[model samples]
Target: MQLVALVPAHDEQDRIVATLAGLYRQTRRPDRVVVLADNCTDATAEIAERCGAEVFVPVANRDKKAGALNQALEPLLTELADDALVLVQDADTVLAPDFVRTAAVALDDPEVGAVGGVFYGEQGGGPLGLLQRMEYQRYAHEIHRRGNEAVVLTGTGTLFRASVLREVRAARRAGLLGGGTGCYSLASLTEDDEITKAVKTLGHRTVSPDGCRLVTEVMTSVPALWHQRMRWQRGALENLRDYGRTPVTAYYFRQQFLLGLGTLALACFVLFAVLNLSVNGWQGAAPFWTAITLIFVVERAVTVRGAGPRAVLLAALLVPELLYDMFRQAVYVKSLIDLALRRQEHWYAT
Candidate 1:
């Protein structure tokens, strides 16, 4: 039951030490900690080395995070036993002290192939950050509601069995999966989502236990949040396209369709509201809709209560969060349009 941690970093000098330190603080520390420093121009590698982590810098890896991970995992998977666990965590996230211990317990079940962390946003982005924090708290609520079944193996932090990863690689090579020969799909923009599909397709369950938690970086501004979500939404659509209507992708397809409907519903609501205001003057709200809105507000407030007083306050504000939801709905629509038009996606820093 050997445990190894691989942190994929690209110019993360500022956050590298803290991330590594979090790993060291784990209740169940990794037997080996390797930092995959991909094309780093900063002091990321040196800093990681100073913190006593083995740094594996990929040679001319242009495929982004997926490529860097494949390069490092190749040797490690080959060297480690089938039962050995490998944790692929983002360099910017800080895991809870019990993250490793809890995730390991979950993976102890042979049927569970991977364990993902329940993540919340780190502080300091002002209003936007608080919104993201509230959103993450809701996500955490959903995970709990679903009994820890992983909808997606988030890249923020996920633990995997070396055997399952090798199986994923073999599945790709044998044409059972679409990610080329590597464990991660080089062509997919959202490698995490694609890998979740791959794992489920292999008949393995993914879980996100409550004790396995982390605090991840959030978008600081509207532009950053927009770009980040665009990539996420678009990448998800593309992965669904690549996988096509299988049992593995059925839920994802439904999710996308619902997202589109949600967007359309919001747009229609705004349009009809303006039309009514111009034509009929300020008519009072209907009781049914008011009740519905109340229910929604209550749900929002309750879901974000774990995020503390400030988050609860924001969730209670209603309009601000509604505006945020409208913005996300727009991203969903834009992502669909971009995918339909076959527009190129440009990755940018948030």
Candidate 2:
């Protein structure tokens, strides 16, 4: 089967070389590498070409990454065979040398439609970056614990059978999926999450093998992280809303509800603590509560232990991570509010 890699990029001149290099270094290198340059004002296309990757610029596409990819996929999919594989990856991600090999192995299974990467953050975002790394580590541990059954086919890197993508497209056109008529939903902020539901709805399974690992860019600042996550959380809610209550979206709705419940629980806990402190003098912590807290702390530490000393230390400290949790909770709350009001949040380009 022909293996094609498509990197959808917008002004990624600074990192295109490394991305291409990672592809070239892959154990199961792609038969062809194409860079979808989406209205780039920089020399991203030139740099990609310099690195010897075929460049395809989407013509005046305003729908962002999803549109650019659709434009490129249209003609390319026509030329490729049904069994051919397409690796849709971000411009800034670097796959492990064996990523392609591992994902290919998983995709060889007729039951598996796509294989996504187990991604970690790239170094250099400071304390915030470290926190995100730890968060990602915990996420990776959870996925591993679940036997690599993926909840989403992350954009960082994912391998798909051309046939499956064609199926997704057909499903969209037939109104079996949302987004009207595309492999990805232009209306959905979190295309990955939306597409995951689409794939599953079509009776195809997705996997995230541990061996298929990659490093993708992380938000370096609080504002960046906030906007990124807001878009993610809000997009997910919107996607679910669009898809409605179907068997495929039942799990996603539960996940979102639990997140909202968690946020509310945290708020209630803080309020109760303040009220108790004001009503009574400082009372020592209860043994039962302390044990529960310990369990949580230990779970945090153990899950991120693989991230190294600093991550474990941070996770154990509790304060930093707790504050980060509060921040994320705030994002979740805001997303819900935005979704309720049908408020429009401008898409922020990374």
Candidate 3:
């Protein structure tokens, strides 16, 4: 496969170097590397050019990352061949040397339209980083369980077939897909998830290949993590709503819809428990709550073992993790309410 790599960036001067350097070291290096310097004020464009990447600073961009990507990819609709592959990697992530090689092997199946690799949180980030590391490990675990059929192709390290992208491009031009530019939605918060559904809705499969992983930085503070998760959860709800509007269920959209319903049911159950605890007193609910807490801690511990002993040890912060999970749960609930009320939400991009 003739490979072309794109890194959509905004003010990524401090970190883009590592990502480019990692790509340069890939066992099967991309034939072309384009760094879409989306309205950057920093040295991001200069650094990408200095690093030997073709830099495209958009004339204008409004939808953040997705818009920047569309601006960059619009031109590629004419540049790519049917046999070409495009890897859309995040500015903040670095990949293993063989990551591209491993993922390319899966594309040989012809039925696969895209490939999403496993991702780990950047190491040595103190408390918040370790917590995020564990969280990512759990994400990887669940994604691996589902094999090659993926519900979402993570932006951290997603490889796409060029033909499907062109099709998406054409669809967007015709106003069929709702992404900001072509394949990625400006209206949705989680463009990766939207792209995954778009590809699947076109009758192609998304693959998850083994031994190909990306490492990315995670939020290092409570406030940052909260905002990030809120944006992510809200984006998910919006995608469900948009997909519902399309009335399409050929691929994973139906599965995601069902999963959303399941989450709503679980949230309702939590609400019932909270109401009972408030009215009947904690004495009666103490045993039930303790068991649930222990289950959460144990499950976290088992999943976090991939990060080594230190992370497994951090899983002992059961109380803090429990509180954090509760916070995330509340975010999920608020997201549902926001979607129902037709409220607008924005990503707190830095």
Candidate 4:
């Protein structure tokens, strides 16, 4: 397979070199590296060129990341041969040595349209950074249990079969899919999810394999994480809205809708628990309180344990997990509300 790595970057001078360097040292190096230096005033394009990548700066769709990616990929994806695979990497993320090899292997089945990597958290920022590491490990472990079936393809280290991308492009042209974002669906903030659904719509599979691994930076602060997740949850909601009961995406749509309802129920339960405690003090709510404690035990022992001893200890500590859950729930509620209101788009640096 001819592997072509596509990186869409905007003002990423501070970190693009590390990304390129990692690609250069890959176990299965790409045949070519294509960088979309979108609206950069800095040395992003220059740096990418120096690293031996063919750079393209697209004029249209410069406002959103999905747009930039679509602008860069539009003509190329439709024309590349089926044996060619396109690997899309976020500018801030770094790949493991064997990432391309692993992804290439997964696509050997021919029916698999896309493959994504398991990501570890980037090391050493602070306590919050440690938490992010733990969070990613736990999440990755959960997804790993899912085997090859994936609801969404991560952008960090995703490889796409050129044939499937051509199918997606044709779908967009025939008006079978939304055209606002071009091939990548710029209308929704989470274009990755939209593209995943579109790929599935074409009777192809998207897989996540353990061997295809990478490292990603996490949001360092509570506010940063909140905004990031809010956009993600909203994007999930938007994808569901856009693709409603369409055959290929009906399962994910129902899943997210039910998840929203379940989340809303969780919020109500929390309110009721607080009210019960307020009305009858700690003694009457002991069982409820105890159940909450057991949740921490399960979370630590079953979930975050993979992150290592520190994560196991922290999950038992419960404070961080509880605080993070509160923030996540708030994000879900806010995202749902905003989507309900049809609020304007919000963008942030990756």
Using lDDT as the measure, the top candidate is 1
lDDT value for candidate 3? 0.82
Global lDDT scores for all candidate models: 0.92, 0.91, 0.82, 0.81
- Residue-wise lDDT of candidate 1 within 115-148, one digit each (tens)? 9999999988999999999999989988999999
Candidate 2 lDDT, 67-181, residue by residue in tens: 9988999898899999999999999999999999999999878999999999999898989999999988988988999999998899999999999999999988997777858
How does model 4 score by TM-score? Answer: 0.91
- Clash number for candidate 4: 1
Model 4 lDDT, residue 270, Cα: 83
User: What TM value does model 1 have?
Assistant: 0.98
* Candidate 2 regions with alpha-carbon error over 4 angstroms: none
Residue-pair clashes, model 2? 0
What ranges in model 4 sit over 4 Å off?
284-292
| TM-scores for every predicted model | 0.98, 0.97, 0.87, 0.91
Candidate 3 clash pair list: 179-184, 179-185, 179-186, 180-185, 180-186
Model 2, residue pairs in steric clash:
none
Please provide, for model 4 over 1-350, each residue's C-alpha lDDT reduced to its tens digit, 9 standing for 90 to 100.
Answer: 68888998889988899899889989999998998898888999998998899998988655567777777777887567877989999888899888888889888987888997777888776677778888788778877887756667887779898888777877888888884636687677888888998899888988888877788877777677777887788888888888887888777767777777877787787899799889987774468868987886876766876667777887787778767666677787788778779886487664
Model 2 earns a TM-score of 0.97
lDDT of 3 by residue, 1-350 (tens): 58999999989999999999999999999999999898788999999999999998877688888888888888886788987999999999999999999889888888988898788999876877887888888888877887745667888888988898988777777877766447678878888888887887777888877677889979988788778887888887677667764533444456545656766676777799799889986664468878997798888788889988988888877755555556666777788788889888878873
